[model samples]
Target: MSETMTIAPEQKAATGNSNKMLFAMVGIGLMCALLIVLTYEGTKPIIAKNKAAALEQAIFKVLPGTMTTAGYYWDGNAFSPLKGTEAEGQRVYAGFSESGTLTGFALPAVGLGYAGEIRVLYGYDPAQEALVGFYVLESKETPGLGDKIEKDPAFLANFEALSVAVGTDGNSLKNEITYAKSGEKQNAWEVDGITGATISSKAVTEALSTSTAEWVPRLYEAKERFKPQTQSHE
Candidate 1:
């Protein structure tokens, strides 16, 4: 071999240009990617807070009352994160009005539906001792069929003021939440079934019963848990 190798003029120029372009492209791509990640991370907390605030506003609008986070709890605990409570402990969120009265509750419950898990929110009217309203958080029911329970106005109206009367036995509803296959409703606990959606109707019934039915009594027990520090003027 010779002492040194010669570089072709055309090949040298092409190689130099290619290396510069490749490095420039890589640098631009990395900057773009970093900017995207930073933007996502920056907006994450704001998005979460907006969602939480919206949900809280919705809950208050459905259930009667004005509130401060002071009286509300998170997760499943009976009260909010008070002193000495761990920030990461079992979550519980309860709500109360300004006057220290037990107004209502926002309970999240789950039930098995014809399609899959049915998540719902039941608003209990403590004054009336009845379910004032309900909202389906989520479900996987068949469209136009089982899912109508979450949207149809007629179906939604049926649940208003539907009191789950705890019977003397204490294990059954004052009137078992049943679908009148043939007769007129004799109690609030009953409703005309979803006409053709038996499983879906029953799924709503189950979620409501498990969520509202059981929690109402427990609420009364913890009624004072959310009492505010009142220093009002006469």
Candidate 2:
């Protein structure tokens, strides 16, 4: 005769309670997930709008003397004005002076920084064939040290008129942008690196170099297109 192993009344009650608790936890998790998705969906447009506004302000800051700006998108062969709210694809900002003269272009570039990717907007003056200004759009660089790339006066001055002249080939930079030790910058195209922010400074240098190499020649060749449009009075 074998004795049957039956759960005690107390044991059965505890097991039931455990199952209920587990189910409750799963339900709570599902509810939390749904809330998160809903909140994200609701805020998406607001976030995008804020970012767009910030970028517009950055364009003006990077290209001084700009009274107005227009967005241009490069579509492989040429550039065209961006349609309303059209933000996708390769794009640039053409800043104009109060007289409607094309002042300079605010070009955005990104590169690996000391802590993460650094995004910057820099002004390219087609007439001067040089970089006129710079501003950090986004950065994850270390504080105090790497942040000096954006704060240090000496470093910021590097981009005031850094040369990015087109070469004889008419398609590439004459001298690639580079960074040098603090107080050691020798050329107009060289950036002065921060004493303790080498990586951040170098990242900005590379980003500007890469961006200018691709955009300078194209902007120079098609600069007339960026001029303000004139209306015809019939």
Candidate 3:
């Protein structure tokens, strides 16, 4: 009954070192997480402000002659001024001229592109039943090819007065938007494709087709809600 159990000095030292390393790594990880949270909190308001400003600019860009803008959310029945932080259903912006006439509505839409998702704002004139202007809010398309959808003059021209007239039923598009090869646009609703950016061009067309199919009818019905008295916020 005489043998005493003992951990060798080297073993004891190794175990102590391992424990220290484990504790150090855990401390570092916790500190890193705390820093990340702090950073995010510190920048949250700034990020929100920048996003709002960008959206304001985009609204004006998509609706020319818009000297002021206002936001509203569609209730089941009609649009109400977006005042509180919370709301239900899709939100839209109404652009007003200096004289307070409602120029158009900026309808936000999203779609999948060649590289990733594409976000856009399209200006619709209910009076003309046409998309008067277009702006890409966000996109991750290919550099030279797909990005041409944003910059190519010929491609951009497609949205100038592009027709999206509602059908006789008043709830569907008369002619769903179409995409054609470069220089082949022959109809009012056909979007001309970029020479090398077919997918991106089609993506834009499809996005407008789907978004307008749903929104144009609703906006047309709610057109009176966007009159001069809807109230503008910031």
Point to the candidate with the largest TM-score.
Answer: 3
What TM-score would you give candidate 3 relative to the actual structure?
0.78
Error of 1 at 73 (Å): 5.7
Error of 3 at 57 (Å): 0.4
* Local lDDT at 174 for model 3: 87
Q: Which stretches of candidate 2 lie over 4 Å from their true place?
A: 1-49, 84-89, 229-234
Error of 3 at 121 (Å): 1.2
Report lDDT per candidate.
0.64, 0.84, 0.85
Task: Assess the local accuracy of residue 67 in candidate 1 as a C-alpha lDDT between 0 and 100.
Answer: 73
Q: Which portions of model 3 show Cα errors greater than 4 Å?
A: 1-47, 83-89, 228-234
Candidate No. with top lDDT: 3
After superposition of all CA atoms, the RMSD between model 2 and the true structure is 7.2
lDDT by residue for model 2 (1-234), tens: 775688465643345588789899999999999999999999998987787677778888888898777888888899877764554327788888989999989888998998899998899998898899899988988888999988999899888899998899888888989878888999888888888888889888888878888888999888888875442101
Stronger candidate by lDDT (2 vs 3): 3
The digit string of per-residue lDDT tens for model 3 on 1-234 reads 775588465653345488789999999999999999999999998987787788889988888898888888777677877764743227788888999888989988887999888888899988788999999988999988899988999999999899988888887888988888899989998998888888898899889888888888888877876766544453
Candidate 3 clashes between residue pairs 3 or more apart in a chain or in different chains: none
The C-alpha RMSD of each candidate to the native structure, in angstroms, is 7.8, 7.2, 6.0
How do the residues 1-234 of candidate 1 rate in per-residue lDDT, one tens digit apiece? 564476665563445587789899999999999999999999988986787687666566556674743324344645444342444222224556776565666666677989898877667665676767678878999998988878877778776777765557554446545565424666777765676677887787776666655566656446566554342101
The count of residue-pair clashes in candidate 2 stands at 0
